[model samples]
Target: MTEGRKMRFAMVCSSNQNRSMEAHTLLKRHGLDVASYGTGAHVKLPGPSLHEPNVYEFGTPYKTMYEELRRKDPDLYKRNGILPMLKRNLAVKNAPQRWQDNAADGIFDVVMTFEERVFDMVIEDMNNREQKLMKAVLIINLEVKDNHEEAAAGAKVALELCKELEATDSWEDTIDDIVAKFEREQERRILYSISFY
Candidate 1:
């Protein structure tokens, strides 16, 4: 509700697959202006581990990746639900947009990331913007476990955050309150207010 304009939010993940897409879908469903992107140097996933994914550059079409993945290991991609995620991603964006690319488009009221690595990348990207955005963007780091089940749960949390923002008139203050409330809790939940410059 900053200046009565609808909030524009961004969600980021490593590969632009599970976590970010989940949050993006929920936020968009709520009619919020939102986008999701990855901070990875290359599109990656369906690998032996998170650290090692079949890497491809940003803006590489999802269809091409899907084909390559199928050719490489049909069963592996199918088992990991990679193709479904790829299809969903392609339906939304023509190709993956890196966090820096998304930032160049426009400033977001709140930029939320599902991982600490992405959180750092966002801050760095913001700092490197050619023209400084006068307003403060509350960069939130929500520690989401990167699995299908956890992504769904993270989507719910993302929806909650969007609802909280929708109800408030002050964007930064509401973010502050949400962060403080989360920090006070003992159990696992969204964490914020760490390095939101």
Candidate 2:
């Protein structure tokens, strides 16, 4: 890519609260120029002061994950704090809509949908002339399995789909591996070209 022509990516997930937020953090940490949005509009972006509805319903797992992220890296909070600064720098009041009426006007080089249904919807739209390209990838996260064997099987399938979309890697076998890949590749403009199902 040229100096100004970085590959942009957008990740749309079921709930922006968990997986998508994690993915966003991972991508940015790796130095990829990426953005993430949630299908469920109410999900809050992860941050020190962020709030979410029914947060109590999610319980310990959510809290544990959030705390872990904070403990592992204090910089997430600082990076997230830059969102407001962008508004001031650009003089734009509000960010762009998720689905712009004019698909050609959008900025993402690749658009990924986490759920199968969302992937199908995006495909259907492409068929209906809603999007200009049909290069979207569907990323499916299988049920949490007890062993690496099961997880690897699921990840293999997911990785194949990414490969078909011309993604750089065939699969990210583990969460830690995925996180590490993101952290190590921050200087290059690599998008975490994935969707969840």
In terms of TM-score, which candidate is strongest?
1
On residues 1-197, what C-alpha lDDT tens digit does candidate 2 reach at each position? 11332455555545433333334444555556556544443433454554522222221243443454556554853365323322221231123223323354455545555556555554454456544345443333323232224323433433332333334332333434543554364321222334321
lDDT of 1 by residue, 73-191 (tens): 88888888887788777776677778877635777777888988888888777767654436767788888989888988988887777667656777665666665665564254654
Which window of ten consecutive residues has the lowest lDDT sum in model 2? Answer: 85-94
Candidate 2 is scored at a TM of 0.38
* Candidate maximizing lDDT: 1
Model 1 sits at a Cα RMSD from the real structure of: 3.3
Each prediction's TM-score against the native?
0.83, 0.38
Which lDDT values do the candidates have, in the order given?
0.76, 0.40
RMSD for each model, in Å, please?
3.3, 12.6
| Residue 194 displacement (Å), model 2 | 13
Residue pairs in clash, model 1 = none
